[model samples]
Target: MAFQSKQSMTEPRDRTGAVQGIEGVLLANRDRIVRFLEVRGAGDGAEDLFQDLWMRLTDRRSGPIADPLPYIMRAANNLMLDRYRSARQRELRDKAWGEASATHAPSSETSLISREQLALVETAIAATGERPARIFRCFRVDGLSQRDIASKMGVSLSTVEADLRKVYAALAVIRRQFDAS
Candidate 1:
């Protein structure tokens, strides 16, 4: 469904008194609801979650909530929690698939190609010099940030960047060799 901007989703109000329904209360506090989602670590998905919240409220046949604000907030929180749980479940499932794949043997041709690629990469890294090789491993394999790599290596940020560039250049040469072969 199309999501409206906060300004476009006008507050639910009749002329008589307080906004009565959950949908009305949510429309009135859309910005605040989004903020609540953000605070709960929805991050970039906060707007989508807010829209989902709106849809759920509209689709359900609920009576007017006496305290719509708190009710809406609780609903938003529950939505975020559900999203988080679903994401986590997805991650675990993917991880399981990956682990299972690691136990399988490749075909002879695939195995040969993988070994050749690994040898080429090792050779390239070695030819790039010790400092650059170490820096590349630290950043890529160890998952260290550039700043962290520099700090750990007792080198300047520029040095870490330069080393990474050198590693990239070496890899390019290796790639060319592979293409020629």
Candidate 2:
């Protein structure tokens, strides 16, 4: 989106021009900001931080900036750093709390349960032996299309289709188990 200058640079009113100039950068850099956060630290909260940055930028209480682009970028960077520190502090505090409140059951018991369920699934797939299992995993779990899987596995498209049938059967059994549960 184009950043329309609401007023001249010399205007005495709110620095609407300055803020509007930065709006384009903000819009274009959203994905870049998210990727930066996802890679550097705030993988889970990148979107939240992005929203917060916009809120801070748009807040009327901040008044007009002399040069809004650099100011907003600096603000975003500072916010990300603050988020990283806060997350680390929270993690440390949670760890200490867990140690103090230790019980017979660990906090990761649910994760263990899920892992066990996944292992059961693997075992079930193992009953189909290696090739079909690999094909099923490549096409399903890895999200490859049948044609792509066939090309990668050096197999015919028909073979890929056949393997998909086995995958469907296995998944139907798994779905039935889930439904029964």
State every prediction's TM-score relative to the real structure. 0.43, 0.38
Q: Tens digits of per-residue lDDT for model 2 on 141-172?
A: 89888888898989999988887788678866
Clashes of 2: 0
Which pairs clash (backbone N, Cα, C closer than 3 Å) in model 2? Answer: none
Q: Model 1, range 1-181, lDDT digits (tens) per residue?
A: 0122232245423312332355567878989999999999988888998889888766654433556677778888888877776665565456547778764333223122347688889888988999999999998898899999999999999999999999999888887776465
Q: Give the TM-score of candidate 1.
A: 0.43
Highest TM-score, which number? 1
Residue pairs of candidate 1 with colliding backbone atoms: none
- Model 2 is weakest, by summed lDDT over 10 consecutive residues, at 104-113
Model 1: how far is 83 from its true place, Å?
Answer: 0.5
